[model samples]
Target: MSGATGTGTTMREAFVATAGHLLDEDPRVAVVLAAISADVFADAARRHPDRVIDVGIREQLLVGVAGGMALTGMRPIAHTYAPFLVERPFEQVKLDLGHQGVGAVLVSVGASYDWAAGGRTHHAPGDVALLDTLPGWTVHVPGHPDEVVDLLRRAARTDDRVYLRLTNDGNARAHPVGAGFQVLRTGRRAVVVAVGPVLDRVLAATARLDVTVLYASTVRPFDAVGLRAAVLAADRADVVLVEPYLAGTSTHAVAEALADVPHRVRALGVRRDVELRGYGEPADHDAAHGLDVAGIAARIHAFTRA
Candidate 1:
């Protein structure tokens, strides 16, 4: 709530600006890029030539360099496209950062298939799922540029292994930065958990339905306590999870959270069953995956009715 007031800036731009500011303010902060946003950081690179690094097109080295920096007690902010950052160098991420037990901020843009024209190779719906394989990683899927500004500051301030997923999609407003979920609307029928940029769509999809809507930006530390509390308060155990990444990525987490209680969860997001082959807008992919407002409303109706 205390971030930007619905600024029109995109999350990617917000990150570049905030990162440059961090380089100016925090001496321990370093930025490692893989030629994704090198042009944007050119000025900063000129200013802090030592701290700002561009490792050409080597993503493996992008993370490797960040790990090396962390070894020297520096908090490195690594940036690149989603697939290149998380999928291409996953082993490096697992070993260089996770296995070595060093901390760095891994920021990514192009959520899922934001670059629909870039095709499947550019898509990374499984990034979060893959990262879940590692322990001690904090994942943040910010829904607004305001949230991005706040989350980046928090990530840069610490040397924790964090993945801040940036996307072209964003909510109309941003909730305060917190580990737990923030309830936007309360209802006794069911609870809808909207992750990151999908909050606005979820709200529109469920506008007529009587259900509780909870917004979550920090998802890695899945707020089980907050989820359980919302479920108990709502009285109905039917829960719906709408994320912007791979569908059911957080289904297991939801199941574990409500393990003791009898609950039913419907996970919705980018599908894993089939790869969308056509090159269209992100909205096309959303419709194909049943993530658009109409698709979401229909799915929610069917799930709740069943």
Candidate 2:
């Protein structure tokens, strides 16, 4: 329940450590890791060899094994980089998990450009978008280590299919888990929904504007009910969705949520039009995608003014 700020723990570290603890605490818990992040669970594998498994560099086998384990009544927590986790074995995820109706907690790190130096092979800006194609996947984008811990635990306990996304980028603070958006700042001009790590940037962007800022750790299952309430409270249809993935990933959901009412929405996130070959750091990619605080502020100002 406590935030991991200044605790010298990264979100990836928290995920691995917490998963190991789950393996020790719960007999039903099984962790399947690719060679990419196997080091994080080294101790867990040593302790629970039967429950903790490493499939080497095989991404398809990673997801297939997890799906098979889930079918046998084990709570499988699969971890790997974003591209390998979701992109490489997407069909396995779609058929093994989705087609079979089995559930597993798919936890991923190196979100989008976290490994910008590693090039496009390491980046996965479309991970969430791809998952969105499937049905009944609970997608969680945790902004802080605390949120990661909480969301991971929640996923482990459920029989529902879940995806916990972790990244190097994070917000300054963490909020409690709940349905819909948690209103951080109340305003009437517009409603800005910041998904996961983007909360900090969105807050900075709209600091001077009289707009409601809502933060969400759980994005899939879109929280249309919560969004409608915020928009109605603001008495305006100006909705700004700042996701951490591809732009407009959730635009359809937002539009559907406000279908009965008159509304104007602007979806912001990483751009998919072109590949950003100038990879250096996450900040560099963020700037290129116009997800930095300055860029977000400019977009918000223009949208609100119009």
Candidate 3:
């Protein structure tokens, strides 16, 4: 219900506002969460402690309880880290959430390796790529603040299973979450589909170059028309699909789907040969793997102009 922004509504403030809004609507919307999404979850509980049921650091039990709560007609928003949400209770996520087709709102903090300093065990970089292949799961990576707010509210109302990837990538701004893919930058230079927060990197990339940036919010339910238009628009330009996961499924799947598109498709992501290490920042880590703005810009320039 909180739609309009007043004067100084930052994304973080809007985030808590949405949570409070949901809690106000129903006091039974229990938040089952762990340590990762502690920030927003805690704030939500602080504002409406009666509605949130904290599960400490127990991600498995947290989700299991949430799934159980879902069975009883309560909306459960499970907040946890990406690695654990999809990794630990993966079976619960599949059976309790997926097979049952229950609606589970997963608010993941630093869902991707966007956590940077967390290292491998903590780095959930490949989670989205993995979720991309999973059936009955809606994977959403909101790049900007507005997209986050809109999608978070929508997800709250949705009665399906979804795992949200939230992060603090330096350029993640507040933008509306459009269903179809959008052309952040329209150019013939080369189509670099900015995956999620990577779109911000895409914008930063354009500061010194002439590259096209496509803001792709929904990774799953891959926007066929939007993606087709975004990709086909390239019209034989060397195009690359960049992500923060390994060079397998996420990239290959996209490449296969858009193979018919005239553009020469390429993928830029974690090499996977080595465990992804970071310099404690999303941009730096992505830059290290040639997945950041400049790196993607370089690839587009090399592939298109080469």
TM-score for model 1? 0.97
Ranking by TM-score: 2, 1, 3
Residue-by-residue lDDT tens digits, candidate 3, 127-166? 7766665587777776655666788788787677777676
In model 2, the worst 10-residue window by lDDT is 1-10
What's the lDDT for all of these models? 0.92, 0.89, 0.67
Alpha-carbon lDDT of model 1: 0.92
TM-score for each predicted model, relative to the true structure? 0.97, 0.97, 0.84
Q: Show where candidate 2 strays beyond 4 Å.
A: 1-4
Better of 2 and 3 by TM-score: 2
Which segments of candidate 1 are over 4 A away from where they belong?
A: 1-7
RMSD of every prediction: 2.1, 1.9, 4.0
TM-score of 3: 0.84
Global Cα lDDT for candidate 2: 0.89
Lowest lDDT 10-residue stretch of candidate 1: 1-10
* Clash count in backbone of candidate 1: 1
Instruction: State the lDDT of candidate 2 residue by residue for 1-306, as single tens digits.
Output: 122468767888888878888999999999998897777677888999999899998999999999999999999999899999999999999999999999999999889889889999999999999999999999999889988888988888988899988998887777897656888999999999999998888988999999999999999888999899999998678999899899999999999999998999998999979898887888888888889999999999999999
